[model samples]
Target: MSSLTLGFIPLTDCAALVAAEAKGFFAGEGLDVTLSREASWATIRDKVTVGALDAAHMLAPMALAATAGAGGPVAPMIAPLALAVNGAGVTLSNRLSQALPAGAESLQEIAAGLAAFIGQRRAAGEPPLTFAVVFTYSMHNYALRYWLAEAGVDLDRDVRLVVTPPPRMVEQLRTGQVDGVCVGAPWNTVATRGGLGRVALRTSQFWPGGPDKVLGARAEFADDDRLAPLLRALVRAQAWCDVADNRDELAVLLAQPEYVGAAAEAIRPALGEELIFHREGACVPRLEHAQWFLTQMRRWKQVDGDLDAQALIASVYRPALALEALGTTGLGAPVLGNPAPLFDGTTFDAG
Candidate 1:
């Protein structure tokens, strides 16, 4: 059996990887896999880049960023499979949420209320509100920025953006260290239930079916002979995780201290409703998805210098490898639904 070490952060979206290891899917593929729980996305990125981890549950954009050297040193990486999607949310402290007008439920209402509130704070000469995200390359960061930008709030000026690991989000909010956060569940669920914050927006509300996390592997390992088995094992694990009957059990498994480490009740909702692991060919790494991340990276000026977008996306997002892995399982890639409209009614043209 081939021995491999994989890393994952404690988030509900890390389910597929946790399931693959707990359910013996990796062993079934004649592979010995050890799952390492890391503290932050940067650790996952650097470890995977330096070969400390054979693969990892990684932010989709982080994989692309690592390859393009956007936010850190360039170490080419590839996402052979997406682990889950639609599992992130933007949450605000109770102080902030309560400041909004009563019954301001929609994103428009929330953003309008927030903009007015920020203006009032500016007049009062109060410090800017601080919002936390898991990492610079994460969709959490991009999604939060996208929503705020549409509201005419300048992330760089009107607010302060900081990096906080998923597990620390709730505590930071509780202690008033940060006013809000954009992070994956069940941290959002944790905050809301603990009465620390209110979930203002689900990522799905804006980018329904958007890419989230993926099975990120270094370039050399992706080309190795073991890549096929690794992908197949993950595909099986993802399919198993998608079954409704398996959710409760999966939640319990994820709630262990070594995994997501939240209560099963907190983890269950995300597994059952908030996250998509394998439905609609969710595991396939779509080029458009990668292109969209690149578009955001450029929109935010994260990617530097002139580079070939198409070629970079082609090299990083490998749906063909997913296809090859699925072939053996007698499964066909399902057609994905049409892209969902953004909150502002804007359509994304990844040109």
Candidate 2:
């Protein structure tokens, strides 16, 4: 088998990659894979761009941002498949957490209380509260921005959003480095349970089924012969992950010292449903999903150049590759579009 290297962070969404290796799906596809565990999102991006690793479990928006010449030097990248969606939550400091009433239900109510907190902090001449996300061009950042923006919490003047690694989120919150965070599990669950912070809202409350991690590769590798075999292997791995019976084993696989490296019980809190590895028709990459990231970039001015989103989607998101790979196998019929509707009833025009 030919060997390839891949990069990933220790998060719940890296399951497909973990499954592919542990389940021998990659070997079945005639490939030998090495999964390098990196510490930060910047490490993933830099390694993938320079070909230090062949591919990575990457943030969808960061790939597009790289193409738009915003964060890094523009690199040709493509995401052949989405790994998972709705895998993150917002954690607030103990002080802020206490402001909300118990059993406070909806996102709207939470946002309203947050707005009041912001108003109070401003009135008292306190420094704007700071929050952290995984990366500058990440769904975590965008989701946090959208949730805050909906409540009239200005990203620029009212509060600051910084980047922090997943493992470090709880310490940052406890030390007052950041008052809140929007990070993927089981970090959020870990933070809340450890009493460092409280999970105020989940990314699902902002946009359910939103695209999360993806199989990101330099377009050179993804657009060539290697892409098909790779996608096929991952598709099979996703199927293995989606089986209800395999859920416990999946958690155990992800918790091994080589992968996510968290406790199995801690890992189980966000597995199965919270970090969805597969569904009836959700494996393929969607153009509208990319468009949502582009729209947020434009809305937040994260891009340096005027990006034609449709063209970017055409270039990077290859749903056809996922479809082609699925066809060759008995992996049921495919249905892989994410409509990505928001909870606030605000529709996204993915143009």
Candidate 3:
């Protein structure tokens, strides 16, 4: 038997990793897995790069950026499996939320209201409003920027973007450290429940079926014999998490102090229709997702302009590994075709 140590952040989407260890899915595959809860995405990246962690629950963009040496150290990584998708939401502090036009319920309306608010702040010569994201390379950052830009807000000129750990998002809001935050579940729900902030919009509203977190491992470990068994265990755990009947138990399990540590009530909402654990080949690390992330990195000037996009995507996203682990006989089709369109009726042009 081979032993591995995996890491995760305290977010609802970390369910599969928590379930794999709690439900003995890892042990069933003859692997002893330890799930370490890390404080930030940077820590997850650094630890995984140094081999302190064998694998981790990582942001889709962070995996690509790490391999390309965009953010921190250049440690090549691969995402053989995706953990979950579309669980992120934008939350504005109650002070900010109330300043918006009343009864503006729809996402576009809320975004427009925010744009108007930013304009008014600018006219009054107020300081540029600040929005926090879990990480610069995270979907939260990209999605938040896309939403604001769609509403005619200049990301670079009209707002200040900052980074905060997922678990600390609510605290930052409560202390008035930030005006808003784009982060994954449990934190958004926790903030709303605490009455410190209001959820302005879910990422799924604009970018349905968007990529979020993945099962990330160092590139050097790809050839290890234990890789197949680990993938099998994670796939099984993801399937287990997708079942509706298991959500209550899964929520309670994740509510433990060692895991997400949020109340089960706050965590349960994310497990609902908004958060997808495994369905529609969700576990497969689709190439289009990587392409979209690369596009965003280049759009924001985070990646080298001369880098080979196709080569980097192919090297970092390995769906063949997932197919190899699950075998061909019963493995369903991969998510090769384009996903559902965004709220504005546009899809990512990964071509």
Model 1 CA deviation exceeding 4 Å by range: 349-351
The C-alpha TM-scores of every prediction are 0.97, 0.96, 0.96
The global Cα lDDT (0 to 1) of model 1 is 0.88
**Candidate 3 clashes between residue pairs 3 or more apart in a chain or in different chains:** none
Which consecutive 10 residues in model 1 have the weakest lDDT in total?
Answer: 342-351
**Relative to the unseen true structure, what is the C-alpha lDDT of residue 87 in candidate 1, on a scale of 0 to 100?**
89
Q: Positional deviation of 92 in candidate 3, in angstroms?
A: 0.8
Best-matching candidate per TM-score = 1
Q: Per-residue lDDT tens digits of candidate 2, residues 1-351?
A: 778998999998888899999899999989899999999999998998899999999998878877666876888888888888788999999988888767667888888788888888999998998999999989898888888888888779889888899889888987889989999988888887788877888877677777788889898886566677888899899888888898889888888888888877778877766777768566777788788888888888776346677888788888887778888877765665447578787658332
lDDT against the true structure, per candidate, is 0.88, 0.83, 0.88
Sorting all predicted structures by TM-score, with the top scorer first, yields 1, 3, 2
Candidate 3 lDDT at 219 equals 96
Clashing pairs in 2: 281-335, 281-336
Error of 2 at 331 (Å): 0.7
Which pairs, if any, clash in model 1?
A: none
